[model samples]
Target: MNVRHQIKDYIEAQPELKRSDMQELHGIILGIMPDCKLWFLDGRDESGKVVSNPNIGYGVQALKYADGKTREFYQIGMSANTTGISVYIMGIKDKKYLAEKYGKRIGQASVTGYCIKFRALRNIDVDILVDAMRYGVEKTRV
Candidate 1:
């Protein structure tokens, strides 16, 4: 099955959700920022070359922020083992600023260079996340 179909099937199998749940979630994310471009990433694990399991079902958005530059906003793979979803803001230099501002609310914050991991989507503050995404986009602009 294709990545989109797999995602749909996986989400549908969950007990608490209706067919519209995943679509609604996707809509909510896009509604927060209409300019974001969504993408699906599919790849094979290097070590599994002999018996490769093509990993898929990752979602991302490339958005342009106020300063007129674009950056990648990614949510890691979807899986039952995942306690919650993650959104990553990468290539950030001002980790301290973001951590000081949103650390407590974003759930398990970590920073390396410009990469900021917002570990649990359900616990994240959407407004803050939007600001952070905008900030990253602005900061990276040349």
Candidate 2:
């Protein structure tokens, strides 16, 4: 199936509370980036071994590795975990920025370098989350 369909299926497969939360986040992120590219990663390698939770990604950025190789990846990504959800803001240079800038203001979430993780949507300040996401998208733009 298509990427959007895959993302929908993944969100729908969550538990009732998580399902609604995921759906809300999906909508909010789309509202922030209406025309951005969409992505779905099933959290497996080419060999199909599960390495992580499934992820739904939005926007795009070309990343350069330490070896000078580059690869295209999403600017913002979200995933479901056992305890809660994770929102990843890729391509930030400073590892402490998110935590220092948004950790306290973002309510109950864990604001890391590239990830904002929380147990539920109602537990966090989504406006600050939106600000963080917008910063990520704008910062990583080509």
Candidate 3:
């Protein structure tokens, strides 16, 4: 299926509450970066083992490895985990930035190096999450 279809399927497969939350977040991210590149990773390794939760991704960022090889990945990603939803803001140089800048102000969520995880939408400030996403996109502009 197409990227949009794949994303829809992923979101719709979630439980009722998570499905709604993911759908809403999908709309908000699209509104923020309408022209961004969309990605659907099925969360499998090359060997076909499921390594992570399926993700709906937005924007583009090239990541360089130690050997000078690079791979392009999403600037922002959203996934539904066993406990809750995770919003990943990739491409930030400073690992501590997210936790330091938005940890206290973003309500009841775990603000990690590159991820903002929460049990539900009501538990965190969606606006601040949006801001962090935008910042991540800007920082990774190519």
Candidate 4:
């Protein structure tokens, strides 16, 4: 329910994580975007109880992208895995189009027309991602 609990539960469910792993993941997240707004989402089952799924993850509001009319920016989604971490770009309207365009250049983990998933944080070109986010926010500003 709470962010910390959700994070803790997510970590614990993995079962194979070492203390150093946790620290490394946390540090990596913080290091990636120091000013990002972190939110803990409760992954729930069909009955609404908290559940675990590698697909479900946390989000960081990276930047507010907007133009004079549209106001939607990119919020980065991140998750921890047994081997490494995953980062995804969120808040896109044409996920399908973007996926098709960037899928080859940047790996597409998922594309439900909302979130553009990717691999580990280091795998992505951060400057390009940030610029895209900023442009999205600025382009969509109302």
Candidate 5:
């Protein structure tokens, strides 16, 4: 019932290949952010509808909405999707930074403003992914 347990269970519940990949990513993210806060989001809204895939998150960032509402969220987040995985690097001001700086070097991943999505870990460069994550965490510090 704890956040760590929830995150572990989520990763273990993935398909064989994705399970291993998720576990690997979990470990790598923890290694990069040793002692950082950990988070598990079941992808539900206030009404409990499943709006998105569950995510295992690392670090901390306070998100301010247009209505002046604020929510505390993770700086780096990972999730398993139908095709593969998504790693979200949140709070970057420039929407094109990730794509411009790491799109090609990151291999087959899709580098959006704050997300790097790929079919598998082998399809991308792990080092570059780590760099992007580090940047996100540092930039989004509260």
Candidate 6:
């Protein structure tokens, strides 16, 4: 199916609580970036083994490699894991920025370099999350 369909199916396949949070998060991200690229990764390698949690991605960022090559990827991503939901704000170069800037204000969540993981949407500050994600988008503008 298409990217949007795949994203909907993935979010709808989660458990009730998770499904609800995922849907809300998806809508919020879309509102933040209304006219941007969308991606759905099944989290499998070419061999088709499950390498990671399947995720829905939004926006586009070009990643430059040390080898002088560049690849297009999502600027933000979200996934449902066994314990909670993970909202990934990719394309940040500094590994410590997220934690240092928003760790304390983001509510009850794990703020990593390029990821802000929380158990549920209600458990975190949505405004802070949006600020962090908006920062990522601006920082990765290309």
Query: In terms of lDDT, which candidate is strongest?
Result: 2
lDDT for each candidate structure? 0.48, 0.95, 0.93, 0.49, 0.92, 0.94
Query: Which residue runs does candidate 4 get wrong by more than 4 Å?
Result: 1-9, 15-29, 45-47, 50-74, 79-88, 107-112, 116-142
User: Candidate 4's residue-wise lDDT over 1-142, tens digit each?
Assistant: 7656666666666545433444455555555556554565454677988674333233333344475354323355545644454445565566575456554565424434444444444555545444444444443333
- Candidate ordering by lDDT (highest first): 2, 6, 3, 5, 4, 1
Those runs of model 3 whose alpha carbons end farther than 4 Å from true positions after fitting are none
| True-structure lDDT of candidate 2 | 0.95
**lDDT of model 2 at residue 88?**
99
TM-score each candidate: 0.47, 0.98, 0.97, 0.45, 0.96, 0.97
Off by over 4 Å in 5: none
> Residue 125 in candidate 3 has what lDDT?
89
Worst-scoring 10-residue span by lDDT in model 2: 104-113
Candidate 5 per-residue lDDT, tens place, 1-142, comes to 9999999899989999999998999899899889999999999988999999999889988898889998988899999999999999988989999999999899998889999999999999999999999888889988
> What C-alpha lDDT does candidate 3 achieve relative to the native structure?
0.93
Report how far residue 79 has shifted in candidate 1, in Å: 8.4
Q: For candidate 1, what is the lDDT?
A: 0.48
Better of 2 and 4 by lDDT: 2
lDDT tens readout by residue for model 3, 5-98: 9998899899999999999999999998999999999999999999999898999989888899999999999999988999999989899999
- As a whole number from 0 to 100, the lDDT of residue 60 in candidate 5 is 85
Candidate 6 lDDT, tens digit per residue, 49-134?
Answer: 99999999999999999999999999999999888999999889999999999999989999988999999999999999999999
State the displacement of the C-alpha of residue 101, model 6, in Å, after optimal TM-score superposition. Answer: 0.7
- Backbone clashes in model 1, listed as residue pairs: 91-114, 92-114
Q: Which residue runs does candidate 2 get wrong by more than 4 Å?
A: none
The per-candidate count of clashes, in order, stands at 2, 0, 0, 16, 0, 0
Put down candidate 1 lDDT per residue, 1-142, tens digits, no spaces.
6645765655566445332434554555555545543444333345544332222222354546789997665532222223333344544655577677666665555533433444344445656666765665555433
Q: Is candidate 1 or candidate 6 better by lDDT?
A: 6
